[model samples]
Target: MPKFFNTAGPCQSDIHYTLPTGDRLPQLEKLIAQRNYFVIHAPRQTGKTTAMLTLAQELTASGAYTAVLLSLEVGAVFPHDPGAAERAILDEWKQSIKFRLPENLYPPEWPDTNAGSMIGTLLSNWAKKASRPLVVFLDEIEALSDETLISVLRQLRSGYPNRPQGFPHSLALIGMRDVRDYKIAGGGSQRLNSSSPFNIKVESLTLQNFSLADVKNLYKQHTEATGQIFTPEAIERAFYLTDGQPWLVNAIARQATEVLAPDVATPITVDLINQAKEILIQRQDTHLDSLAERLREDRVKAVMQPILAGQDLPNVPNDDIQYLVDLGLCKIDNGQGLEIANPIYQEVLPRVLSYTTNASMGRIESRWLSDKGELMPMELLEAFLGFWKQHGEPLFKSTPYPEIAPHIVLMAFLHRVVNGGGTIEREYAIGSGRMDICLHYGKVILAMELKVWREGKRDPLDEGLQQLDKYLSGLNLDTGWLVIFDRRPDLLPLSDRTTTEIATSPAGRSIIVIRG
Candidate 1:
């Protein structure tokens, strides 16, 4: 039987393998021939290692070069000791070569010593003895310590001039980040410039998730080997939930094939895919755990707050956004703003961050807004404001993420309101105008746009009006409400403040502005 699961690493020949559907391969192949140092980066499990391995195999099979795959992850464990790390790396190199190439074809002169200098010496000797141009692929390059990483980069730079005559012809560094972002601290406050060390890098390529067609093609592999097949709806559901994430696609398929249907009479359907997704999430598998791990970082929170609040994130550095994208936590939309990459990420984030607090909110069914199937817009806003008045101060104090306290409370309250009856879809991005929250009940749609109250200014009102109008227009609705949290201690409510319906933008819909 063909292997179906590939969670630990790339799929092998006997395993069910899906060809890379990304467009980077042709450019990669071209770069390899030119003997250039390049970088391959992507979020974990997006298949960077698999792509590199496959490319290495293809390059070796073409009779143009002796390609090898090596990993530097082991070096990350001993960040302070470059010597031992280099030894571990050399040992892994030997194992990789033995696994891929025949014993006779393996270079016989490879140095057996674990010394730091031996790394460059061994590669140099092997390249000189090789019959063709040599290519070296270093996977998990980001895991190496600053000293070791710099050592590796400098060795490659030192050997670059020799090229096919004395050293490896080309080299590739594969990792979770681009070379420029590497921060290596050494003896007594000395810092290494990662990009400068590897200045010879010709191109940086990022591997993307599988496409819809690729998901179909992958599923077909299982069907071709076994007699079972995925129904069209099942395939569509898989794409919807996974957004073509390689691991998720394979995992959901494997669940459906092996676990969901033990008999051939049952057809794989959308329901089965949904069941598999829930199981996967509940299992807290490595994929979900890995994605959630970044949420604990302050930088990740800095980028996510605005998206959650439906407000523009000002002064956020470009590097921060790039970091989140590399982690696969967010993606750029229309080159304008960043949004969570997929539903699974969206669902996992809020739950992982607020599980304890949400649970303490006391069963939503017994809470303040449980009487009606869906709370009326103004009523829900008023209740949340009241709850904030009583508990908001404490909640904000307890929150680790103060910038997003209001956002978390609002989401929690809404989640409480719709706990069992409906769903709320949220959309926000760093540097976007505002966060958009759409509460969906069978047919009744309540769209809310949230904005932080700017002290001593009416700009929040104008911003709120503009955002509510946009939300209404996007949902094809005629009217919507904007709720603003006034943080000013001195400002008293306008008891006579009536809800006003006014045209916001010429092309946008009119909005109901509620000032609290």
Candidate 2:
């Protein structure tokens, strides 16, 4: 039986495996033949190392080239000292080859050299001895110092002409960021020439999570191995919670098969996936830790804040957006907007950001009175506005996440309304304008979009109308509310602001407009 769940690096012959599902494999295979220097990057735990190792084996087995997967991550542990970095890498190279290759083929001893020049020397020596074209897969390349990176790139450039004979024919640098975007501190700003050291990269590839079909294939692997069947509904539920992220996909299936439904006769259902998701989130594993770490950066916040506020983001540079996308924190939505990359991220980001504020917000979770047990949308808005009027100035002065205060207040209000009866689903990112809050009561859904009104703006009515229209359309709801917060005190006459119910949006969908 094949070992199906692999969390470490790529799966070996004895371990379980899932066939590559995304766009990366074909691209890597093409690069292997073309002898390109390129990058493979994605969120942590997305199986990058595993995929590269697997690809290397495939290339070697074909007898067309000699492939080796080398890790530079150990160099990172030594800081920027090139000498130490070189020694560590040489040590790792020896160990990796010893473990992966036949004993007779392993190098007996590595040549001594300064760290800055060791990599180039090592590669040149290895290439001289090998008969076939050498393909080097350098994993965790980002962990090396900027100077080391520049040196490495230059060495590759200096040795390219010797490829297919005297040097590695194909080189792949794998890490969290693309090779071009990597800003190696202290390294001279020499633009990398595609034609030189590692030119002719067929493409830069990112490993994506499993698709719904991929998710089913994963579960099918377990069933084939253990004879445990997962109900179709359970599969759908797993997709809904994990959005087909590779780690989460494997995790959910593993939990269900091993813990939730170990017996083949027992049916794995939707509830089991949901239960597994909750368990995973609460555990806050390394996957979650890596994602949360990105949130602390100003760049990430700048992009995510507007999404939480439900406002349109001003045009940001393509490079900035692409950087975040590469980090797996956000994605371009249908080429129209940006959205959190996955359900788990969508669920956890806000909670992680609101951990401190949610406590105070929780205080008002059930403060309002609604006899029908429904959130009185207009009433809740008015109550929040009234509080904002009296305490807004001071609260803004003290709030840590002030950029998202209005949204937080709204969440606090909703938390009060749905305290005992319903749940709120929030979607917001720093730069993605517009926050989506879905309040659910059993089967009924109440959706609201929150926006911030800038000074001198014409009430933001046109923009608000357009956003509400899109929100309602997406939810397939005929009517919903647009709550606009006027940040400027000059426009504030608290009592005169009105809440009007409109029949049709200027764009033509019926929406309720509530201004405060």
In order, how many clashes per candidate? 3, 20
Q: Against the hidden reference, what TM-scores do the models get?
A: 0.81, 0.80
Cα lDDT of all candidates, in order? 0.73, 0.69
Cα displacement (Å) at residue 213, model 1? 2.5
Model 1 lDDT at residue 289: 89
In the range 1-516, model 1's lDDT, one tens digit per residue, is 555756667767566556752353668777877878888888898887777787778778878778878888877766677788888887788888898765655775767665566678878888888888889888988787567777878888888888877888889889888987765765313324348888888998888777888888878876776767788888988997888888888888777777888665667788888777766765768988888878867778888766666556657778888888988888887875678887777767765666545665664333334455545666665666566565554555445567676567666777677655666666666665466778876567888777767666565776667666666778988767676655655665433232334445445656656554
Clashing pairs in 1: 310-434, 310-435, 311-435
Error of 1 at 378 (Å): 11
Best candidate, TM-score-wise? Answer: 1
For residues 161-264, write the lDDT of model 2, one tens digit per residue.
Answer: 78766778888888887766654565523323222434545567788877788778878877787677789999988887777777878777777766777677
